[model samples]
Target: MLHLQHDRDFYAWANDSAAHLRAGRWAEVDVDQVAEELEDMGKQQKHALAGHLKILMLHLLKWRYQPALRGVSWRLSIDNARDEIAELLEDSPSLATKLPEIAARRYPAARSRASLETGLALETFPVECPFTREQLVDQDFLPDESASGQA
Candidate 1:
């Protein structure tokens, strides 16, 4: 559980770091070391961390690629991407907290899927359980206004 929270904090820091980097606020950007530390926390931690990292990386890629190519308004793109990332994070509460009972009851299949989806990169940790949209909804893990449409 502590590991899970730590990974979530790492993700939040990485998101802030990426935002700072994008805004040219270099002094505020400081997530590389934190990311490394999160990785070093082991498999479970990596699993939780990777999902959040992947979303952040995806936004970074979008910010980098789109601006270089189409010149498609970077600010708007980033805003949209931020919303999407927030949605993804909200949808996966297990990545934020340890809910063993929820994991046992509602997320067994999702956990299995997350395991296969994350593969070798995050498999080394004991915290690599994957979750599904159905489980997320069933357990009401996400906020009322989350992407799951329950709100």
Candidate 2:
């Protein structure tokens, strides 16, 4: 019944599936759907971490390259991304183990995105990320905005 409901009414399927599991009616539970949902939930967290990293990296790039344009909004964006990344890691400590992998995958997209949004040449930014993962997430880190000699 739950399996049939899964195709027809997803919400009903979820409720019925959970009810069966709690009641030990394992035979009636949709194990395949439940397993898929569990896997997706884990993926969601990893994807979230990757997204936050990209945003933080994008802001960092903008801050580094466009030092004169830096202002309160950019700082807020950097801080918000930093705080969310911290909160995500604190909630899912295991995600910390994959931070390097996430950074590698997300940085290119971030660089491209920053370039597109800033109307800068893609080549303007390095092909690889300049900031280390530690510095990327560091609360005090702002990617040497001083390099551009902006006050």
Task: Estimate, for each residue in 28-101, the C-alpha lDDT of model 2 and write its tens digit.
Answer: 88798899988998899999999999999899999988888989999999999989989999999999999889
Assess every candidate by TM-score: 0.20, 0.87
Model 1 per-residue lDDT tens digits across residues 1-151: 3345446786776676667778998766555665666567545543554443333323333332233442345344434534553454476544444333423442334334434544423332223323333433232232211122112
Scored against the true structure, residue 24 in model 1 reaches a CA lDDT of 90
Off by over 4 Å in 1: 1-72, 97-151
Clash statistics: count for each candidate: 6, 0
> lDDT for every model?
0.42, 0.87
Off by over 4 Å in 2: 146-151
Q: CA shift at 20, candidate 1, in angstroms?
A: 51
Clashing pairs in 2: none
Worst 10 residues of 1 by lDDT: 142-151
